[model samples]
Target chain A: MVENTTHSEPSGDDIRPPKASIGVIGWLRANLFDGWLNSVLTLVTLFVLWKTIPPFFRWAFVDSLWFTDGAVCRDAPGACWSAVTTNLRFIIFGFFPYELQWRPLLAMLILFFLLFYSRDRTHWNKYLAYGWVIGLFLMGLFMKGGLFGLTPVDSTQWGGLPLTLLLSVFGLTAAYPLGVILALGRQSSMPAVKYLCIIYIELIRGVPLISLLFMGSIIFPLFLPEGITINSILRAQVAIILFTAAYIAEVVRGGLQGMSQGQYEAADSLGLNYVLTMRLVILPQALKIVIPPTVSILISAFKDTSLVVIIALFDLLKTSQTVLSNPEWMGFSREVYLFVAILYFLGCFSMSNYSRRLERELDRGY
Target chain B: MTIADAEKVPFYLNPKVRAVFFQIGVLCMVGLLAWYLVSNTLTNLERQNIASGFGFIQKEAAFEIGESLISYGSADTYGRALFVGVLNTLKVSLIGIIATVILGTIVGVARLSSNWLVSRLSKIYIEVMQDVPVLLQLFFWYAIFYESLPSPRQALNPVAGVFLCNRGVAVAIPEAHPAHAYILSTLVIAIVAVFFLRRWAKTRQEQTGKYFPVFRVGLGLILGLPTLAWVAFGSPTAMDVPVLQGFNFTGGMTLSPEFIALLLGLVLYTAAFVAEVVRAGIQSVSKGQQEAAMAIGLRPNLVLNLVILPQALRVIIPPLTSQMLNLTKNSSLAVAIGYPDFVSVANTTMNQTGQSIEGVALIMLVYLMFSLSTSAFMNWYNKRARLVER
Candidate 1:
């Protein structure tokens, strides 16, 4: 097929594209200035950034007063970062014995370690579950500290970041199995159990979390016999668990419904009992399908732990408020709030990012 | 032999028998717990001498609410105060839902923009707003409103008849007149007419391959009819401009600081979630659909209206409804900012009357009613939006 035609192949250098269509300039043209409207939009955004960024930077960093006393901060023209830096301990650990603050810190470190370890799906097994159980017990022991010759700090003393993590983490851990059970009940053929589960789920979901918290605080006390009292923190914890379980049940129910009828029929053909079928076939797939949504629910529950502040518990948000209420730190609310918000943002952002990654990974498997 | 074997099965081992037994056990346990709790509650109430019924709702509230829709005094009954709270809650939720939809749509579209900076900025907005705890955001906004704003004497008047101060934002509104009522009625009529016109146009388009400019006509009818009514009744020009009197602005309508802070926080927070829902909805529509519409010589806007939105809306509505319900529920956070919402008012009632049971029950009942009604309406709308299949 070598016809005698006067043709020559292009060299690599000749094949190279023009500079205007490949590098940073190319990106700018294609993404930021693809059309007249895009170019205008790019310019307007830049203008807005120019207007906002400099002032914010100057206030937050340049003119900010850090490592200073309240008297000095009051006179400063910008943000008072000292409010956060000086009271950082109180803000992070709250009213836990000041000398024993390391206990709570250690507890949080363990919690974080457990969370980080569990992030890898390959490590998710019976040992990980055992690890969580042991870790939770250690955390409680450290926070309470009656055993191991440690000072006996009451549950009432628990507050700040540790308290926030404890409520959400403990609440979610206890809630997941209950939520699954509720979902199974809702899907059961027995009308009584199904209706009961439906009522419980809808009742919890219909009202706001605050209402349930109110019942916990105000009505639950009256429901107890005289001289038998429960701590407000425990009450709030119960409320959060009950509230979150309902939401998780709904998400798990979606997963259950999404399972094909063929899967169930196959289990039946294998002569598996209902429990065995659910345990070996249904729940494994359903729970995996619902991991992303369950994570979302957990993240929201984490955020909602702040609502305990309304009930007068000293979570991170409440600690910040307590600090702000002091006469010495009266005017540094913006700084204190910004710091707390960053803490919350980090927790939420990481969880959501992990969920997205997990979603993609799960998608690849199928 | 099969029937005889089934009858020979042990009652405890039979699946149906076990199911019945389990249900009865659950019912018994639940009933026992309820009985125990009620007995304890009664004994405790008697010991504390706290009146248990809702009889306190008739008593004088004796506490002044910071804001109310209707004229309310400390002498007003608790029932009246509760009603006012419900109205305030509805007002905020309705306005917040509308604003959230508008802002969320804009942000969602911007996130999909071809412009890099625009999309990036919107992404940043969604991330930051979603990541922050909403209660914290509410506190932030409330701080800005209460701490940063100037006093009434030093109010910032950025426009002619608008005042911004620590007290609240006061904006001039048209003076009340009979013509205003007529104009409102005319607007309602125009809305009804447009509804019928849309149906007629849809049928006409289906029967005959023709298009109708229903939007333009509807807009014209709504606006023109209102204007005509105003003109026929001698168009009123007077406005109730705000004027500073004593320590506060008088005359113009003032949005309380609590209301503004609550509204702002709810809209900004909920809009982020709504934007994500909308983005997912739009993305769910395959690119081929748009290309196919464009291939048929439809204009870009026409492609969106005729092909894309109808499909995207099906995916958007269900999640959007939940977001709306979330906003409604989150409005209960108004208690944190002291916004005299239903929960806050009920909380006050509980504290005052010591009728915690009644107060808590009312709160649950009202919220349940709201949730049920909202879901019912949304379910209807979702059915309408669903794809029709043979």
Candidate 2:
């Protein structure tokens, strides 16, 4: 009976999908050429890519000048990537003493280590927080060295990538707690506190960061006592902190508003005070819910740190501009700016990707 | 357990008492800080001999604005220069918002296209645009305009009467005439009429179970009224084509490179965020809604308009309002790119007069006014879009 069945009936392997409905051709047909309109769109897009990509590839790679001097680059028919390669040190560490470049570089490595180590959800604990605190301390010591047998560098001399990182990371770290407090104050039942928090948030958020930086650079000194001057970097950092805190407060407020009444009532029924309720019950859940958005705020704040260039702070963008203004690097603004943009893009992209992953990981619990 | 017992509770321990005391304490601390800052500011201003008041706004600006909507020169007052800056800011922001909405909507829709290539391309565009800083993009565009584009003498004239050069885009436009104002007024009147007509049409459709071609009629009125007004006032058809004069073009509109770069960067960068918002809004409307509408014999276009869009827009408008506000705020980055926006003009004023306090205050006031007005409008719109519950 088995031999008869095998000879007369077709097996599962033989009864496969039709040739037109499976494999690469089917994929192409289904995805790109499903209908007349889609087919036309596919053709048009292909044509556009065909026209643009080859020329761009030639300009950016094939004929590009990588290590040449400005004179050769001027006559070259392609991009002068040497503008970035030659000024790499200045672009990364700004005016920090030439020999002491390793300090910022080392500090950056430590920052990256801390960041990478904390990326996994399993590693998230109080120890990770402690790691950040210690790592930040080391970074500070390295950047401003007086006790480690290293040359003391002025904060004004701190510029470029490290400065961008410092402003965004430290600013966000400091801002988060203040933002939480502000959010709590806004959500409080006390009218006076709520109004005060609301007004502060609204006022800070109404104006752009440029105006705040302007205030820091131009108007902040007037608010200080005579003979006491804050450095420009510190002023900018403070402005960033205040600006970012306002946005963070708004985001956290959304988280707070999203909590169900039942959660609060349950906490109350458990005889918990407001602080305990928020800390142990409400905030833990609310903060988790808002993690994705808070990361977005952080990403934007990181990008906004580049605005310090407007006030003449030698952040990465400003350093790139300085390089472009050089006689040797003249007319190579595109290469330098492109390089700086890629740096910023990488930082932002990785953070956004992490946020998305975290969102998915958190969603798994539901 | 009695009210008397509650009143007898320790004042420090009573929640209400603690709340009042906390508030009072906050107020006192805030008042003291404000007082200290003001005193310091006054002392510093006196020491620096920098006059701090709005009176400086009336002084001659003595600085040339690259471009201005109104008639402005270096001889203009600081107030007038600032007004020009305000106008420029409004011009860029309004134009940027419109362009961003259009481009963002298109990209957002493209991201969901049935064609995989189209969707992937749009996704890449969004990711790249969103990741890059807007200021950097502005700088990049500015550099391209200045360093890549040819000189005015060798401008790329893709079409007759249009010039693309390092200087800016010079385009031909219809010469201004008095009749244009009358036609513009009629256009506004037609728009108002269309609004009421739409309401009436909706009401009629609900009560009498009949549809009115409100859209077609509105379009006809909007276009026909403006045309009739133009004809009645003697159709002025004079064209003011840009012509090369000396090193630059004159006699027609010339959009400065700074404005172009700033507008392009702001629109491109903000459109990425708006695209995400739009995608989320569209996705929020469930597939069942579309299926149900189709089952009820509604046309595809009608299903999209009557069922999907109304639902989706409710999800769209709140975040979209924030995106608009963000675009407006980011336009302040024009200061970096040499666009004589409000912040740029204010910076110049601050530097010239050393009245930093007044300049900062004015900047804050103007921006706050913008934010408040926008939020107010959006709040009203959100109220209208909200679902009506029984």
lDDT of 1 by residue, B309-361 (tens): 99999899989988998999999999999999999999999998888899999
Q: How many residue pairs clash in model 1?
A: 0
lDDT of 1 at A129: 87
Write model 2 residue lDDT over B1-390, tens digit each, in one string: 999998888878989889899999988998999999999999999998887679998899999998889999999899999999999999999999999999999999999998999999999999999999999999999999999899999999999889999999999998999999999999999999999999999999999999999989999999999999999999999989998889999988899999999999999999998999999999999999999999999999999999999999999999998899999999999999899999999999988988888999999999999999998999899888889999
Model 2 C-alpha lDDT per residue in residues A1-366, reported as the tens digit of each score: 998887885655567788887899999999999989999999999999999999999999998999978888888999889999988999999999999999999999999999898889899999888888999999999999997598899998999999999999999999999999999999988888899999999999999999999999988999999999999999999999999999999999999999999999999999999889999999999999999999999999999999999999999999999999999998888889889888988999999999999999999987
Docking class of 1: high
Tens-digit per-residue lDDT, A254-337, candidate 1 = 999999999999999999999999999999999999999999999999999999999999999999999999999996789999
**How does residue B119 of candidate 2 score in lDDT?**
98
Clashing pairs in 2: none
Model 2, residue B220: what's the lDDT? 100
Query: How high is the CA lDDT of each candidate model?
Result: 0.94, 0.94
Interface RMSD of each: 0.9, 0.8
What is candidate 1's CA lDDT for residue B217?
A: 100
Range of the 10 consecutive residues with the lowest summed lDDT in candidate 1 chain B: B379-388
